[model samples]
Target: MSNRGGVVKTLFKRDFVYTFYSWGFYVVLFAAFMISSFILKNFLDGIREEDILVSAYPLNYPLFISVIVISIYLVMLSGVSISREREHGTLEVLFYGPVTAGNFLISKYFKDLCLGIIALAFCAVYFYLVSLTTNLGFTAGLVRALVMGVFMISCVVCFGLFISSLTGRTRSSVLVLLAILGGFLALQFVHAALIGMEREALSTPMLYLRETVSHLFRGINWVSPFAFLNRGLDAVVLDSPLLFGLNIFYAVVYSVIFLILSIISMSLKGVKA
Candidate 1:
């Protein structure tokens, strides 16, 4: 038991150090903050033009934008981690030690989660400074959103890890990951377009298609990590403690299930491409 614990610790420390120190992580973080700064600049400009600002959660949108940016980079990184290691033969070499698929993947999972937390910390600092300089006031809602972001990033990490375990090559992992995410995005766009139009104005075929896409979109609420993000953010906006807590619980379940699935996949697939 102690040996397994030590193995997890060693692997996690190595991965955490390598990734946390890498320029890629900070580069992605800088891009996220830059986009948030742009959005906030526009927001401030609008407020100045109007001479007044009235909103309960002014910083929430910028926070969400930043979170999305971080999630995208983290997702791609997680997606390629397992496959890249396998393709390069590092995974097999590591497994010759005390490492099993379980410890290896768990280390990778926790490493990404820690990275997300660090990214979120940067976001908190950025938003707080923005509030201080602009007098926009960093509301509690922003803090709440940041908290929810932890769970959101967890789901995203697990989702990407699951994809990583399924494919054996970096190219395949990336292609598959993008295709699945793109399909989710397309479904969302179609559902929104349909819902926005008057039902009575739609033709019969269009109505049927809308029904199909709506079902798919609703099903994606369980599978798509971004769906969890949207739902979690909504819980924060609604200020319903019960709903907020429930969604967090759901996110935990989602992560656990995906984590188990990824482990099983790695075990079955082995550490070779």
Candidate 2:
């Protein structure tokens, strides 16, 4: 038991160091903060000179944006970690040591989750500074959203690892991950559009197609990590503790299912350079 813990810790430390020492993670954080600042400035400017902007949690939107940015970076980092190790023969070499598929993938998942937590900390500090400058209230809702982000990031990391385990090359893994995520986003947009359209304006065939897409979109909500984040964020905005707890449960289930699939894939595929 101690030996297994040591192995996971060692791998986790190595990946964590590599992630922070590289420029990619910092670049992503910088971009997120800049975008948040830009949006906040414009939002503050839009208020009428005579009118006051009363917001319960103005920072929640920026926090969500930051989470999205960090999630993308960490997901890509998780995918690239496994694929790059395989491409460079590191994984195969490690397999000759005490490493197993379970520990290896868990370490990667933990490393990315840790990175996400660090990013969340940075976001907290960033938003605090923004609030100091802009008077945008940092309420309890922002804290809830940040807490929810941890679960959302677990889902993202597990999903990325699953994709990485399936592909031999780093490029293929990233491409496949992007393609699937893009498809999910496109499906969601189409479903929203269909829902917003006047039912009477649509022909019978169009209505049938819309119904099919709506069902597909509903299914995707269970599979997509972003959907979990969205649901959690909505729950926070709505102040619904029941919905928030349910979303957290769903996120945990999603993470566990994907993590198991990732481990199984790695075991079946073996380590190849």
Best by lDDT: 1
For residues 1-273, what per-residue lDDT tens digits would candidate 1 score against the true structure? 598888988999999999998899999988999999999889889899998885678899889999999999888989999999999999999988879989898899999999999999999999999999988888888899999999999999999999999999999999999999999998999899999989999999999999998899999989999999999999999999998999999999999999999999999999999
Q: Which whole-number lDDT from 0 to 100 does residue 62 have in model 2? A: 74
TM-score of each: 0.97, 0.96
Clashing pairs in 1: none
Q: Compute the lDDT for candidate 2.
A: 0.89
Flag regions of model 2 displaced more than 4 Å: 48-50
Q: Each candidate's lDDT (Cα)?
A: 0.94, 0.89
Model 1 is weakest, by summed lDDT over 10 consecutive residues, at 51-60
RMSD of 2: 1.4
Cα distance off (Å), candidate 1, residue 142:
1.3
Model 2 TM-score? 0.96
